[model samples]
Target: STQNANETQAVVASVLGLSANKIACKVKRLGGGFGGKESRTIPLACITSIASYHTKRPVRCMLDRNEDMAISGQRNPFMGKWKVGLDENNKLVALDTELYLNAGWSSDLSVAVMERALGHIDNVYYIPNVRAVGRCCRTNIHSNTAFRGFGGPQANVIAETYMTEIAERIGMTQEQFREMNFYKEGQTTHFDQELKDWHLPKGYFQLKEKSNFDARKAAIEEFNKQSKWRKRGISLIPTKYGISFTALHLNQAGAMIHIYHDGSVLLSHGGVEMGQGLHTKMIQVCAEGLQIPLDMIHIVETSTDKVANASPTAASASSDMNGMAVKNACDQINERLEPYRAKGLPWKEIVHHAYFDRVNLSANGFYKVPDLGYKWGENKGQLFFYFTMGAAVSEVEVDLLTGSHTVIRSDVNMDLGRSINPSIDIGQIEGAFIQGMGWSTTEESLYFPNGRLFTQGPGNYKIPGFQCIPQEFNISFFEDVTHESVKTVYKSKGVGEPPLFLGTSVYFAIRNALWYARQE
Candidate 1:
């Protein structure tokens, strides 16, 4: 059970000139993936397998921190240029953008990543007559691969930047501009898929009210007028992220489960536990499906033998896919014991009787996301199962002397449908927000002229520290709303990647604060 364990097994088998079944891959857990381990782990496994095949002895390969940074890929660096035509009411009439992405050395996952970026160009808005093109430029540096949010965050940043600039140019608030262009139900995306159960507007107003955005803006303006060295600004941003693997076949997952005569259960799924609470959620899923105590279920380590041809656990869909698979497997076992339960037998007795009756107590479950199709040339058909929506309001104060800023406060309202675990979902929302803030403000990957990465270690690479956090952080989830189009396990939506886009508000807020300092 390795991260991207299925692909790693295949690659290793091919490298060793053996069948995939002959090789064994097992991983207990990953420290952190953040989309880095999805493909980057494959080469390491392949190289070690090759060495073992030739030497007829076990071999291993592991990269040091500096080597990993220098050799492994980073997120694709993009330079985007766009032109927009708007009506008098600030509604978008046309949008044409070209994105040049530095693919760096080789095309690892850049092609798929670029396709996602192009599809997400509109973000939460309805933009008709849109023409977005992505060009992957080959560079001399290490090949850039996937990161968290895949390419959705980069695409959303492009649209959000344009919205901010257009709002400033037209003398309207960014909030107003965003609201006017919000996607409504029945409206189609640029790719020709209908937007159903649109939640952007509702989420926007909820965040606006919760953050006291209008009053804070007025107060900041007044404070700026009185202060000489400090200025403050606030912004609200919305996100509508589509949930599914753009590649349709990669949307499927497999799970296996077994029940012991002692009433204990074992669960295995294709998803890796990267500290995102996937295993915890899986346990809850099994407990709920089997009506068993949480302590009775144990999640085993990931193994290619247990779940073959498994999809990588990125895209925030791990819970939706793997959790459903686990539930399905549990349901199968429960079905076999339903008659015993109907007879009013005890759970322990049911298990005891199940073994005596030769009733199968083991099951294999599989799930594939439905209705995902896309024609790249035409950009038509449904590429997503459903959309996850959220919004955030960020207030910031900028220093006039140094180009530094601090988040004064932040308010977030996200729709997680019916959350399976509120605590874990909230943690993901907050962590993604802070990581997005780091990407937008502090994390910059620098390189020398000779294509050497200069920011090789943590000392030079600035991540958002404790000090960068907002003094007043308020986070809440929308209540009583379920996704209309997609039926997930427990009616829950993906919470991993969508909230990262909410941090875009921080960037626009800092931009607004800079406007005042420039006027002075």
Candidate 2:
């Protein structure tokens, strides 16, 4: 419990002039942070707790949406130029990019965030001489905050744009361009990260193939050959998202697993579940570890009192970290039961004796990823983990006269390592795709000059509704593929953020479709 939201403690800290060291804070599940809760939320809670302690009265202060939006942060509005050096074969040789991130009023977490952006600047491609220099421009805008992809989405979008530009310049198909440059085995990334032992390079490729990207491209080309009013475009993006806190040491998670006498199990981990099936995965993990039925386990909410010193569920590390922690705890209990199992005691009998003997049925487990290290300004960061690759082929119908773009069908092929829950996994892919679509085609941020956010109210800001959603959306995870070195037993990486970028591809595809329609 290091941070909180109460304002009273902050007021007291100001009045009594106490340092943060003199304060205690409590953290709970946040509905959504978009990176806002990473560190900044701590200060508010600390202030409130301090004030409550001093006032001897129940104290509470919550920010209204207007105040929340005005005072809180949104994704940094980045402006930059990107160029990729490619060989005649369309293989990417190098990338040069200059990024300007509007850091807003304070540094906050932008430095670390942008570092991750630069680290993942190439997304899933292999480019040797990649040079990406970023400047966190201090703008008067509300402190630019983090969203789902953090800086990864913005940074990767530029790469996708660069690919589109290259395809246009060479008259090669976008699919061809991507196929040529994707991070294949033995390919080293821009940050000098080596690509090794990929589970399903072909699995990702097959998704693109099954999605009929070539046919979609052909249809767009055919349409462009006839259209005159509007133009349509198609772009495919892949991700090899490294799952961890770049802070190395923060790449850890803790959990507590307890089995009651009645055979029901309680599970708590450091990662919070924000409707991402994190809790479901935890249940699966616990069940797998104990060789117990899934329904016998109850996954509990994340709390400091239960599993302390936990990391935020961001960076796509929730499953990797918490899964490991939970697995470790289960392994310990299994080890304790090994002696009884060796003596041919029934498993239930072992459990009964362990409880009767007052054996510690609860275990705290921890884990940190191994062999990942990085340094600043390195041409490549050695990747202990890789970017999970995916490609989307979207067809759209655009009304050129109205500047309205409608997606007809979308085919998403994503490298998800493995699908733990087929239905839940697809939902993650589909939901994120729609959300990302909103970010590109509909979601726009407006602000006032005095550093106030105008998107504070509902009417002023617009997010895509179902009416604007794509007509036919098809989402699939590359199932026959698996990553080898990944921590999970099934080699499944996080599916929460990568698929959001698919929505952007739909937007780009609509733009391409519009261009084609105009050519006709």
TM-score leader = 1
Error of 2 at 54 (Å): 2.1
TM-score of 1: 0.97
- Residue-level lDDT of model 1, residues 108-203, one tens digit each, is 989888888988889888888899989999998998998888889899999988988898889887788888888888899998989777767877
Each model's lDDT comes to 0.88, 0.72
lDDT of 1: 0.88
What's each prediction's TM-score? 0.97, 0.90
- How far is 179's C-alpha from truth in model 2 (Å)? 1.8
Predicted structure with the largest lDDT when compared to the true one: 1
The residue-by-residue lDDT of candidate 2 on 136-253, one tens digit each, is 9887877766677777777877777777778877998776777676677866666677666553357656766777777777777777667766566666666656656677767778
